[model samples]
Target: MTQLPSAAPTIATEPGQTEPAFRLVAVAIEARILSGDIQPGDTLPSETNLAETLGVNRSTVREAIRALEQNGFVRRETGRKKLFAAVPQSRDISRRLKTAMVLDHVTFEELWEAMFALEPAAARSAAQRRTDDDLAALDANLAQMRLALHDSDVLTDLDIAFHHLVALATGNRAIQAARLPISELFYPPFLAVISRLNAAERLLFAHEKIVEAIRDQDSRQAQDWMEKHIQDFQRGYELANLDMGTPAALPRAGHDKQ
Candidate 1:
């Protein structure tokens, strides 16, 4: 076990530093985790130990731990007080960005523009990089999608998962990360269109074409199919009489239910 430095610099509450003691403590712990001093799944020191070591109150240590947990740097097991160090997952960070985009009144046009640039490129990369396992996952998603053609809610979820699988197949973390936040915002709106139009079969068809191109390692074909699939989204928006320029919002519960 790599022990924390015994003579760790105590968090200083310098008069003019102005930052809260808990924030300073949180930053210090975060830096240690990022620097690999504390690895994921390693048990973090107790609040008492952390407070004593950092020369802060246990209450401050508690507050810092709460912040760390919320940000995905630390986790506590169910019914347990022991905290574990953890690296933030992409989805964890993406949720915050997703919220900000919604609050900023991000439009469908903006999300569509971003997806237009990312998804096709992701498809191209996936075609070149995908493994047998990636093909299996995509196949499973397609199978489910086919069965759900007339069910908008299920179709909406499958559509998002299908695209996510394609991004994962790319094995490009940058592309995956870039698309993660935009996807929830970009795809859910399609639920409204899916509910309103006879578009589910069209969506399933495009997904099939995209997957077939990916399986054949036809990068250009995959990219082209994905591009058309995305364009169909905008067309669906227009056909449903929804304004693409309107600020995107999360789908209401049961919004996809006919």
Candidate 2:
């Protein structure tokens, strides 16, 4: 097992210069996780040990761990006493950020712009690198989406899964990691738009075309088709009477409870 760089000391400086003790610790721990020094499911050092090692107060260590847990870097096992480091799923990051966006009222236009920038690049990569397994996964998700036309919950899950499959097909872990949260944030509002437009068939048709392009390893076609497909959803949202200037709302607790 490789060791990560030691955590840096937390220092007080002028405002905007650096984060306080807790944030610094959190960043150091996150770096270890990203670098694979702290593998998923590994136990972190006890709070007292970490505090002593980092020359910080135990309260700072506690705050850092709380932040990490909130971000899905660490989770408490059910009925278990210890906290453990974990690999974060894209859903985890998206959920937190999307929640913040909802509270801050981030506009649909902002999200659409971000997607337009990211998805086509993902499509191009997937076309070049997708394997048979990746194609099969996409096919499976498409099938689920087809069956889920009337089932909003299923449709929503498959929608996210479809993009996740694309990211996986790209064979770039960094892209996959970066893409997940954005894709996750994109889907619920998209599902809302789809439901409103009665446009399930059209959406499925576009998905099929995109999948075929990836299956055929046509990078340019995949990129172009994906961009169009994503843009089409934005159009659907507008056509469905959604205010593009209004931020997409977060799902309330007990909403879409799946």
Candidate 3:
């Protein structure tokens, strides 16, 4: 009977564990961060300490830390040797999203739809919550815009900035974060419309109306003007002969940021 206990059936080979050790280390740290075991601004253990605690080589720990830094999970202060934990900034995430949207060939209509929802909400909230400083910034933007109307490059940038200011005026992080990436995505085809149409005067008039509403704390008027402004943008696009059916694109290479 003992001799009849033949060798167990050979098992099929499992998939190979081919991932590098540093990735596992980085993931472990990310888990710690998400679990709140390692809070932002907390100093990370030294390389030697991590190597020993993690049972990995010092080189592996270093590589893991480097990966975390690149992903905005960790950072070192200038002239300081210690590494600090960090959460990624909204702007960094928005930049990455902008790149991804361009790569994925997202369409203009998708961006416009997103903005149509967010922009009016931002205007409505800004009217209710904006501070004196917020009004000052919007006023400054409007003044610059008045001078830049004929300059497409400056005007487009101001237009984008103007909307950003409106979102900022809302004093709502949720609104700001939701709108940031879409705003950046919203500008390329927008510039195409800007270049092809005599839209600046109309654009400035709408901005002035929206600003006046915000100044007067009239949420309804603010939302109404902003919605009309966005609608005017669509109309300008139609008049420009640009095809809305086309996928979104990166700004033409020489164009400045808008």
The best candidate by TM-score is 1
As a whole number from 0 to 100, the lDDT of residue 90 in candidate 3 is 79
lDDT of 3 by residue, 115-197 (tens): 99999999999999999999999999999999988898888889988998999999999989988878877875586577568
> Please, what is the TM-score per model?
0.90, 0.70, 0.84
For candidate 1, give the lDDT of residue 106. Answer: 96
Please identify which of the two predictions, 1 or 3, would achieve the higher TM-score against the true structure.
1
Alpha-carbon RMSD to native, per candidate: 3.5, 5.1, 9.2
User: Which of candidates 1 and 3 reaches a greater lDDT?
Assistant: 1
Q: Rate the local accuracy (lDDT) of all candidates.
A: 0.87, 0.78, 0.81
| Candidate 1 TM-score over all chains jointly | 0.90
Candidate with the larger lDDT of 2 and 3: 3
The list of candidate 2 runs beyond 4 A from truth reads 1-91, 150-153, 253-258
The digit string of per-residue lDDT tens for model 2 on 114-217 reads 88888888999999999999998999889888888887767767777787788889998777766665566678877766776677777788789889999999
- Candidates 1 and 2 compared: the better one by lDDT is 1
